[model samples]
Target: MTQVHLLDSIFTRLVAWSIAVCTAVVLILGTLVGAKFEQLSVDMQEAAVNADMATLLDAYRDGGQASLASRIDERLNFRTPSGNAPHYLLVAADGRRVAGDLTDWPGIDTGEMTAIPLPDGSYVHARAVDLPAGQRLLVARESAMDEMVLNEIGIAFVIGGLFVVLAVGVAGRITAGRLSKRVGRINAAFKNPDERRLERLDRDRNAQDEIGELTRHSSEALQRLNRLVDAHRDTLDQIAHEMRTPLMHLDARLLRAIRTAPDDAAAQGLVDARGDIRTVIATLESLLDISHSEANRGDPRGLEPVDLSAMIENIADLYAGSAEETGHRFEVDIAPGVTVRGEEMQLTRLVTNLLDNAFKYTQSGGTVCVELVAEGPVLTVADTGPGVPVEDRDRIFERFIRAKGNHGASGGSGLGLALARAIARRHGLVLRLKPTLRGACFEVRPESTVDAG
Candidate 1:
């Protein structure tokens, strides 16, 4: 059960107010009651001092308890005292007691009129009188002490408690609402890469507050990331451009050796050299693509619906025969009209990489399959091969990482999966390997990151 803590910061303030209000009400009521009780007691004492004892005795004997009770009632009513009740008693000489309904004196005597104790532990007025018959008379009034004061105090406490609870609840709700709104704004701004104001705000948090410090640190980290990305892009471009010169020269030398080879072995060596050069060129081109994708990540190009199933089928068909020649069967299971939001060229590259991986890893006579399943706006690509090991599954998507003991010597630069992930991210899509048995399943999550629905 959830408990309300009245001593906490905001609740404490409300509780204090409630206590003050209740105490003030109780104190005021107690003062008025005590003062009135004092005045009534003094009047009763004076009446006892000036009583005609013989007359009181005669009235008590003739009129009985009712007459005595009536006389005290009259005295109190005429006095209009605040603390005295309408019922009282009068004791006569010879130990005879006369009261409205009281059978005995209700309190201890202090030799003077103090408070008349009632059976219920409250007090009123009690006074002793000396009669002319040498008998004594005690006049006492019945009244309730704390019950009336407590009744008033209880009402005040209830009202104060309600106000306190309401105030605390409203304060907490307002606080939570403000915090949620701030969090929502931050999320919306971060999602919009085009919003410079959000970027600036992220850079400006330098105060002592935790959120401010965190924002400042994040801004600094983002700046460093951008710098690293720029440097990486420049390096890739430079390396690719520089390697082209040496690759072209190597191609020229191989061509001359092919044209004037002294023997069949020499000509074959040159052909082998040419193949190696082609592989290097392909690797460099892949690196350049990775760099370009990273550099252009922030570009907000409009998205269009493209048939992903058709693209998957095209790539699978292109490599179907090649896989067959390697003693592996290649097939495609693509649903028709499964449209997605992205560039056609990037999606093609993504599909091709997956198929290539499937063909490269599976043993001879093993089956390689490419599939596209669309559910609503999501696109999935599944392949059956020697699936990636659990520990290296996520690592394979990083740049230049290849799973150990799997497809390491399979003539790839290990950038295929990385490039695919990059392209998917640029289009605001999440690409992750879905868990599966006997195969690798990669999911292209719902394209909700774009401006479109």
Candidate 2:
């Protein structure tokens, strides 16, 4: 099974989206709340500064500049009820500072609240008011408390957001694991649609989610498909069984007729007829074998561990004498210690059919080579005969198909390659015809290590 990364799963994506939306909402609300709080603090500060300004103006009116200056000095030294000390400045008509902490008059209209930049690179919120003699009364205070509260709120928001994202990520990972297991179960059940396996998914059928609907639908579909496939396989098996008896009887009668023929010409004709009947029977048998192999594709009973290297070597040795008599050079290169789990008879027939086709097609003095490689559990069979035509290559493995020029000379039943391919599939191997310059080259290799068992 291929490994799925956690970040690539749907669960991770959902959690990420949730975190993103939550972060945005938190940021927006934080900004709004901070702005409202800052506004309220500024309003309270403005009111307090205005009341102090009114008191200074009243002092100036009653006792002149000296009395107002004394009051300003007294208030500057004393902290207000809120424990925030206020800075005061009284400016004369010539724009010179008359008293208090401020060195000079600020650049602002009377009764306007504005930030005054101090020489120390800090600022104070100040409101100024006009006095009787064109003097200005400026009242200012530091804004440390408002700034501290806003900073705390910002820090809290960051910590809370991170905690939310972390929690979401952990939860997402757990959810993804559960979903992956369910998906794996569904896939395994689909591969081998047996009743007991399909019933396992019934536990989740009542769930009110998309996965539940999918499981229910898939179970139903698989059951219907398996039924149809079983019915079709049964029908084919019955037809193949019914035809074999009559064909055997006909073949026997033809053999008897050939033996009792009067002359060479008549005997030869009967012989040809018998050969034709035998070819038909061979084709029928090949068809039945292919059907049976496909019907039992994933059945464990059809498999067994076999020594592949030894099997190929034995088959090659059996065909070596036939190759010598026919004036062909046969070579076998069998690699050692190669084994596979498959039906021994089917594997043997796969190798035999390839050798038979190669030997039958090659002219005298042509060479046939069989090679087995340990890597990939690969098998190769090549012959120095006419290669398959490009147009016929794709269709050559199809049943009842033979290349244009191969019919009369080879006298093949046209089921050799097709049957070989079916056997290869039964063993979970790929049988591919490789392109060659002079002759046909066929390779058989297991698709994966799982197929080897």
Candidate 3:
């Protein structure tokens, strides 16, 4: 897994997009409402001013124009009977100034209430009406207070919108983080594709959400797949057990026929047939060994701390006669007390498989070296032969797979290294091909690659 940058994270992107949507919505709605605030404020102010205008018009109708003049003068002086203070304008049809505080008609749109600016750099909301005899009556209120309150409300909306966006971002972060963690657990479960090693994904199994359902399905699928794999392994084991008897009987019959052959040539043919049967038996046994190791990989039940140094020395001694027979120089570099917890027989087979490959692949007079070190308790077996191609390094560890460009020897059944790797993994270690300037090198190290079964 690699570190994801903040901007690259889907959670961060969602948060940013959410904040953007919130801001856009707020600004759009606020603009729509804000554009109407001045007019809306004017309409509210019109209610009070219109009532005052009605009273003055009633005065003019009941007690003549003189009574209206007197009322306007009293209203300007704050002495009017009206509860609200309002400014006024009255004009004749000739544009003659009627009784009012204003020097002239402040010409503006009429009928509906609208905002108007006065010379003092202040706003007023006013409405004009046609009176009798072509007279025009205008009513207005100074709107500084209304504008102040509206400005404050706009500021509040902006602050509130920012807070809402922040809250949304926090929520998005938490939700995204939780989802990422759940998905990460699923990834960890399938990280190892090996069916035997892959863990079951079983988080939130009872949950009704998508991830929970996915986990449930994944676990079920894994169980079915593992069952099928176990069945297949059982069938192979049964077949190997069934075949071993016939191969042993055939080998015995060939041995008996070879002793009673009519001549040396007839005996030689029997010997070759026996050798072919023996090869088949060895391949079948190797397959069974690999299967057993893989099935119990990481099981610590029967493991013992075996001294790797002594084990390598013993195997080397066993191969000493073969080394002498082939005129190959056998080199040993064993670090004493290099011990590891493992099945002794499986561990011994692991050593033998690597050494066998070395001896089988190397030419006469070539060098085969075995090394064990305490640092990793690492074991290394190097041979002087045509080295494995870089591309085939990993493939050669697979059962029945051999390097395409080898030293002209079809390494027997090609399961030696595969079985070796299986045994190493069973003991919670890693067996790998080491890149060497000389012939092939195989290494088994205390590289923990498994957990307890």
Candidate 4:
């Protein structure tokens, strides 16, 4: 009684079909039963008429009116086809009631030599008679007292149809519910690979149904899709990382050559061309690395123990001369002996990118602090200059991401942080921003690490 509609679901379709079946059954059965009932009534009426004719002929032969009438009444049995006995009556051509059963008349027509209603509200038709007497005999049967056969048959048919429909509906609902549960489980597994509770719904395709086959195919499809995405990501990261180092070396050599060249105009022009070529190569490599890191689907790098504290200090020392010449305070506080497991070159690049970004954003006289600390296995870099805005902090770490007015002011490919993060992940480290009111803090965690000594 939930009022399921025909179009709602597959279960509804089944229910609708069952209803249609029942309706058809009822119509067919009703027609057959009705026809049988009519046929039986005609047969009974014909039998009664024949019996009346025989009785009338016998009366003439016996030559006894009273006894003949009595015989006719007894032979008719005064009972209708429905089995409810009622009195039998006869009306002669003289319009006089002869010796018979009923006295009251219920207005019946006896004509056409076919079954007809008599005056006693019973049905009768013609019977053979002696023409000289101008008398006709007829047999009458009561409609209500006739057989009640079709009533029970109709009831049985209706009950049976109802039971069949109910059984079908229940079966359909159970099947649909099971299908829904299976689909839900498969979807959950696809969304979260870490959860392995879903059954191998996709493993088997032997079922002769469409849904079963889909389940089997979908499992393979999802796995293949995941693999492809991962491969693409790894390719992008590899292109970016491999290209950056060589580009740096090329740029450094170009600038060195330009500085050492003579003051001739032709020599200067060659130096400028080399610089331009180096810039072009660096740009192309940076763009690719940015694209790859943003995908976050690549294979991570190999990990090795790195002296992160010393790494930070060394970078600071390398940049200290410029900081002093520019009248900027370059602070360095790297706790000694802090070690992390990561790709050393990649981790160095990560720190270097952050330092370069800080130097670019801070004014010449503004202070830049580089502090490296190891907490357990976590390495944190906190800088102080004009810290990135809350809105721009996360975006700045992205490749080709530059702050307003900082574009073309520096010679970076804008993929340093992106590549750094990629390398960190490859080494199985989590690199993220630590909340700070100062410049920026990028923290990297090694899988197995210890505090700085």
Candidate 5:
């Protein structure tokens, strides 16, 4: 049985599309949020820097340049909520630092918010003012603390998004696996209809889901089909049985007529009539065998472990003299202990029918081969003669259909292979006509990869 896996169908598609959409949304939102945070951090730092510069200008007007320098030192000593003190730069007309942490004037236009890089890879968001008496003042906030906040935000969102995607994937797999197993159980018996397997399988058939409805419909349909087949088999079986006795009585009357014939021509005519009656009787028997086998397929009541090797060997022994008398070479390769559960009588008829077909077509000096392998209980019968045409291969197994050319057997009612296949299917086996380079070959195996019908 070919099982459906979660990764093969809808579940895989669901996971893949979810990951794609989730990643895209995360990337877009993460970029926007990070950019917005950086903008707000810069705006707040610029506001504080501008306020400090305004206060220093007031101090410059009140207590002169010395008062301004004093205010800058006081501000640098005080730290903010972020635990980083402000940066300051005071410059004279000669472009030299007056009293601040910065060594030189950073290249910036006055009265604008600017980020100046420090020697230690951090940045200070600053604002500068061209002050009174050709001097300058710059006030700044250390923005590296805001960068750290932004980094933590990015890391948290990445981890959280990936965790969510993984959780969803795991849930999808579990749900799909449960559904697949349930559906597989509901359909397994239907897939093996060749053996007429119709076990009572009901997996949530009353829950009103699509699978439940499907299960109910399949069960009902199979039941209806089974009833029709049973009725047909019963009618045909009864008809064959009723006709067989009168045919036998007619055969006895023909035999007596042949004995009392007044001339050889008259006796020969009666013999022909008897032979015709025998053909009809053989055809009816074949039909009954087919109906019986098909009706009882998959029923294990009368099955037993039969030594297939011994059975084929015995049948071959009986055909050996016939092959010699016709001057055809018969080859046999019987592997011992090839046992399988089946009706021995039906299996014997299957082998016999195949061998009979092989011998019926092969000319004198031709070859016939029989091989039995222990594994698979595989059996092959090949004959060196004109093989069946490609167009006729499938129909030859059909009841009452025969090929009129090449390998077609004379005087056949066209039910031998049909009966053989029915018997093979009844025992959970397959019988198929295998194509060969020269002549016809038939193989019987436990199962076939393709439909031989």
Candidate 6:
């Protein structure tokens, strides 16, 4: 069974998408908030600079140029709440050196707040106004505190966003893992419908969730399918039983007619008819055997440790003489101590069917080999003949399906491989046709170590 991992399930993907969407929203909102904070900082600085400019203008109006220059000097040395002094520049009518720190007035419109680069390589927000007698009053303030505040807000957004991503991502992964485990439990319950163990499954079908609904619907469908399969198998068994009686009676009558025939030609005709009837009976018997094997696949009573190496050797010995008489080469490579748990009769038939198929299809003077390896309880039967065609390889194990151009001298009913596969499955084994360079190779082996001794 293929495992359903958390990362491979739909729940995990949905969680990831949700996290991505949330992260994007957080980033967008954080950016907007940060922008608003920066804007507020700029507004407060601009208002402070405009108020200082208004104070200098009032001083100039009351105390003339000299008094305004003196007021500028006083304010320049005064510290604000943030411990940064303001800057001032007073330029004369001829744009000469004024009575403040700046050498010349800035070329800015009256009352326009803009960044002014100072001689110390630092910038300040300033507002300029025309004074009496072509003098210019430029009042400015340092903006370092505003930059620091904006930087702090940006840092906080980054830290908060990262924390949210980590917390939500971990939570989502944990939730998805839990969901995957519940889904796996449902899958385990559905693996074997014949067991009818869905009702015994440990699931919360009453909870209002997608998983609960899925579990309920799956259980219902499996129950219905199982009921239909049981009914169909019962119908087939009844029909086969009903036909077996008539077939036996018909065979007895045919034998009596052959014995009482008046002429050799009439007797031969009766014999042929009996052969045809026997073929039909054989087909029906095979069908019943296949059905029985499938129905009893899970039955523990049919399982026993059988020496597969010994069984293959016995079959090879039985067919060796027939192969040599037909001018064919027969070989066996059986390894001792190769044992597997299965029905002895069915395992023997499985090996015999493979050998029969190999010997039937291979031409005279061809080679047939049967091999058993201790490892994996693996058995291989290979024949040097026309290999199965690529198109027919998939269907060759199906009942009544024969490979194209393979109707050899010994006629076949085409149930040999099908029965072999059925017996293999009933024994928890895998039987497959392997590709070969010159001919065909069929392999049979236990699917797991539990099936092998």
Model 1 residue 344 CA deviation (Å) reads 4.4
- Evaluate model 1: give its TM-score: 0.59
Evaluate residue 60 in candidate 2 and report its C-alpha lDDT on the 0 to 100 scale: 84
> On residues 157-239, what C-alpha lDDT tens digit does candidate 5 reach at each position?
89987887777767766776666665675666565432334443454567587777887887777667667767987888789
Q: State the lDDT of candidate 1 residue by residue for 148-197, as single tens digits.
A: 55456556656665666567556655654544444443444444433473
lDDT per residue for candidate 6 within 1-453, as digits (tens), equals 467575778988988897898799889988899789878877987888888887877888898998888998887676675624588888888888677778766678876889888888888888888877888888888878777777887788888888888788889888887787777767766665545457644255775898888878877886776786678778888988799889889999999999999999999999999999999998998888788787756544447888887877887888988987999999889999888777899998888899888888899999999988888878899999888888999999999988887643357788989999998888878899987898899998776653443
RMSD (CA, angstroms), candidate 2? 3.9
Displacement of residue 8 (Cα, Å) in model 1 is: 19
Candidate order by decreasing lDDT: 5, 2, 6, 3, 1, 4
Judged by lDDT against the true structure, how good is candidate 2?
0.82
RMSD of each: 8.9, 3.9, 7.6, 13.0, 4.2, 5.3
Candidate 4 per-residue lDDT, tens place, 267-365, comes to: 688677777777777677656644544443223233467787787788888989988887778877777898865557666777776677667767787
Off by over 4 Å in 2: 1-7, 35-44, 51-55, 58-74, 77-85, 94-96, 106-111, 194-199, 253-270, 293-306, 406-408, 426-428, 446-453
Task: Return the number of clashes found in candidate 6.
Answer: 0
TM-score of 5: 0.81
- Of the candidates shown, which would achieve the greatest lDDT relative to the real structure? 5
- Candidate 3 per-residue lDDT, tens place, 161-236, comes to 8988889888988988887777666655544324433443554566789998887777676567657767876887
Give each model's clash number: 1, 0, 0, 14, 0, 0
Where in model 5 is the C-alpha error above 4 Å?
12-29, 61-64, 81-84, 192-203, 252-270, 287-307, 339-346, 374-378, 386-409, 418-437, 445-453
Better of 2 and 3 by lDDT: 2
Candidate 6 error regions (>4 Å): 83-85, 94-111, 118-120, 194-202, 236-278, 290-327, 333-348, 371-380, 386-398, 401-408, 421-439, 443-453
Scanning candidate 5 in windows of ten residues, the lowest lDDT window is 192-201
Q: TM-score rank, highest first?
A: 2, 5, 6, 1, 3, 4
